[model samples]
Every structure is written in C-alpha cells, then in structure tokens.
Target: MKTVLKALVLLVVVVAVLAVLVFTWIGSRGISARDDPSGLETVVARTMRRLAIPRGDRNRQNPVPATEEVLAAGRAHYADHCAACHANDGSGETQIGLGLYPKPPDMRLSATQSLTDGELFYLIENGVRLTGMPGWSTGTPEGEEASWHLVHFIRHLPEITQAELELMQEMNPRPPAEIRQQIEAERFLQGGDPPPSAPHAH
Candidate 1:
C-alpha cells in the first residue's frame, strides 16, 4: 500500500512540473520566432483569435461625434501608450508589434468587419493578459481615466483618411487625466445618475 501511495505522489509531482515547463516554453518560443516575420504573424494571429476572455461591455456608445478636443485626447493616449506598439496611423509598428508571435490586428482595415463597439469595449477594459493589450483601468480601479476617450478615438479611426489622420495627429490632442478616469465602483456609487451622454443629445 505504501509503495502505491508513493507512486501516486511521484506522478503528481511530475505532472505539475510539466505544466510549468509547457507555459514557459510557450513564452520563449514566441520570442525566438520573431526572426521570421511570417511565422511570427501566423502565431500572433492564432493567439488573438482565441476566444477573447469574456467581459461585460461598458455599453460605451459613441453618442456625440468625437469633438476635436475629445479626439485630441484620444490621440495623445495613442501617441504615448498605443502608438509605440500599434502605430500612430493604426498600421501597426514593426519591431515590437510585428516581431511578436501573434501580430497585432489591423485595426484600420478590419474595424468595420471584425469588431463591434461592445466587443471592443470589453476587450479594452479587461485586456488580454500575457498579450500586448493592458486593460485600461479608466472605468476600473488602477487604470487611466482617458480610457473611454481613447475608445472614442478608436471608434473614429476607421473613417480617417491617411492625410486626415495625420492632420488630427498634429493638432496637439489632449490626454485624459489619470484622476478623471471613471471606474465601475464610481458608477455604482452614483446609482441613478446618468452617464456622460444621456438621451442622445447628438
């Protein structure tokens, strides 16, 4: 009986070690594949295609067309945080983005076809871990407030012409403050209070 128990314990230990090894290998395998762009793109495409982690969409609708002020704020965030990885024009960057095993999605080309405002909201808010996206805590604790504004900007992105995109970029857009960021807790606190755009004033 003792011999059987010992065998079982040994098997459990081996299985645990193998699990860790597999994840570590996945992490490293991606880095090495960067040398070959095609292979890297293939892998990245596969991973992002994985069912996005389920999250509640903020119902963050685009009520009013983004004003220059609002769009500017979004642009600033994109330039500071996202542009490095996703690129200013939404074409995506080379070394950091393209080099990744799963290449970033082409937001500019596919926004209309591939994603919805709800799916985009959920994905941005929760973010995919171990992936390039870091969930914006704007509406959540520990995230920047301008996250929604960033979302506003993202919604408008598909319509931008190549030249217009540049002009808007150069317009010195504002950045959403770290404090003004709305989170779920605050909304709960307000209870009956209406959201920023109420009754479709547009």
Candidate 2:
C-alpha cells in the first residue's frame, strides 16, 4: 500500500513538471494560427483525439454498402459542402484550407486513408475540437447515412479519376460575386441594364 502511494505521488509530480514545461514553451513561442503545430503537439493532439472516441464508436462498422449510387451521392455532397475547405480532390489546397493552422489533411494520403471507416464517420459527424472542422450531424438517419457514404468516398479518394473530379467541379458552390456576375451577364444578353452594384463598405 505504501509503495503504491509513493508511485502515485511520483506520477503526479512528473505530470505537474511536464505541464509547467509545456506552458513555459507556449508562453515563449506565443500562439498563432499561422504557425504549424510542433511534432510533439501533433502527436499529443492525435493521441487525445483517438483516446476521446468511445471504444464502441471506434469499432463501429459502416452500415451502408459501397456502391456507385452511394459514391455518387457522397461525391456530390462533398463537392457542394466540403470542397470549400477539403477541395474537390481532397487535396486541402483551397485558400481557406491553406490558411488554417494544421491545415486540413490531403485525404488521399495515408494519414487520412489509414483511419478506419468508423473513425472517419465519427470525425465527420462530431468534428475535431480546436480545429476548422465542424460537426455535420443532423441527428437524423438520413444524415447519418450521408456521413457513412462520405466514409466510402474518402476511401476512394486515392483512386479518384479526372472524370469524377470534373463532375465535382460542376457541383461545387459558386461564390456570391461570381453568381452576381452571371446574373448581370444574363441581363445584358436579354437586352436589360445590369443591376446597380451594392455600396461597398468604407
């Protein structure tokens, strides 16, 4: 009993010292979204994320089957919703993606591809904390199924063809400015004056 108590006390002291050193390092480096996470930080964060997931969730199997229909649905959904950050090719090369600290992973890479289907689905539904990812759960069966479809699509990213990529580009959401330009161009073609531009912020 005395030995156990001593071991516990030593563990607490070691943890406290590590905490102090981490804080001191942070204080010296300062925090910035522009800075990439250190290797230690990346390992710690990934470990925490893995540990945070419930064992049942981590081991859960995908209920949806991988089929062309499901993959198409996932492709369209990803292009319209996730492409803004994840990119159509899952390259994570969009302007917003590049600016994010610890920017989104290239889904084709092993780091992302190696994750189990369950892990991918959980991350999509629940999202990672302290990152740009947002929980996409709609709390409905349909929503859950959509996320499952996405897991299959993520797995397919490595072999995505140019034809599929072209289809995704068509599905991607257009910026408001581009939409407005299209409207104005249509008006001009129909022999109408373009609408006046909204006042710009000073």
Candidate 3:
C-alpha cells in the first residue's frame, strides 16, 4: 500500500513538471494560427484523439452501404457543405483551409484514409476540440445516416475522378464578391454598363 502511494505521488510530480515545461515553451514562442504544429505535437494530438474515442464507437461498422446513389448523394453534400474547407479533391487547399491553424488534412492521404469508418463518423458527428471541425450531429437518425454516407465518400476520395471534381466545383458555394463579378460580367456581355472600379484605399 505504501509503495502504491509513493508511485502515485511520483506520477503526479512528473505530470506537473511536464505541464510546467509545456506552458513555459508556449509562453516563450507565443501562439499563432499561422505556425505549423511540431512533429511531437502532431503525434500527441493524434494520440489524444484516438484515446478520446470510445472503443465501441471505434469498432462500430458503417451501416450505410456504398452504392452509386449513396456515393452521388455524399458527393453533392460534400461539395455543397464541406468543399469550402475540405476542397473537392479532399486536398484541403482552399484559402479558408490554409488559414486555419493546423489546417485541414488532405482526406485522400493515408493519415485520413487510414482511419476506420467508425472513427471517421465519430469525428464528423462529435468534432475535434480546439480545431476548426464542428460537430455536425443533428440528433436525428437521418443525420447519422448522412454522416455514414459521408464515411463511404471519404473512402472514395482517393479514387475520385476529374469529371466528378468538375461537378463538385460547380456545386461549391461562391463568395458574394465572386457572384457579383459573375453578374457584372454577364451584364457587360449583354451590352450593359461595365463593372464598377474598385475604390482606392485612403
């Protein structure tokens, strides 16, 4: 009993020391979303994420079957909702994605593809803390089914075709400025006034 108590005390002391060191490092470097995480930080974050998932959830299988129709639905959903951050090719190269701290992963890569269907679904539903991802759960069976469909779509990302990418591009949401530009261009082509010039900064 005395030995167990000593071991527990030692563990607490070690953890406290590590915490202090980590905070000191952070204080010295300061926090910036622009900076990429270090190798150690990446490993720790991944480890924590893995540990946080319930075993049952990690082992659960995807209930939604991978069908052409299902895939098409997933593709459309991704293009409309996820493409802003994840990109049509799952490359995570969009301006918003690039600006995020730790940025989105390239979903076609092994780091993302290697995750089990359940893990992917859980992440989609629950989201990661302290990251750009948000929980998409709607607390409905339909919502869960959609998330399952997305898992299959994520699996298919590596094999996504160019035609499909073009389709998704058309479906991606355009910014208001881009929409205005398109409208102006269309008007000009119809012999209307040209687009207004940008105002100069004072």
Give lDDT per model, in order. Answer: 0.63, 0.90, 0.90
Clashing pairs in 1: 44-101, 44-102, 44-103, 72-173, 73-174, 137-143, 139-182, 139-183, 145-181
Question: What shift in Å separates residue 95 of candidate 2 from its native position after superposition?
Answer: 1.4
Those runs of model 3 whose alpha carbons end farther than 4 Å from true positions after fitting are 1-24, 180-202
Give the winner by TM-score: 2 or 3.
Answer: 2
- Candidate 3 has what TM-score? 0.78
**Cα TM-score per model:** 0.53, 0.78, 0.78
Looking at candidate 3, the ten consecutive residues that score lowest on lDDT are 193-202
Q: Which candidate number has the best TM-score?
A: 2
Clashing pairs in model 2, backbone N/Cα/C closer than 3 A: none
C-alpha RMSD (angstroms) for model 2 = 6.4
Model 1 lDDT per residue over 109-164, tens place: 76423565666656666666656777765565435346656667777667766776
By TM-score, the candidates rank as: 2, 3, 1
lDDT of 3 by residue, 2-113 (tens): 9999999999999999999999999988887767788898889999999999999999899988999999999998899898988999999898888887888999999999
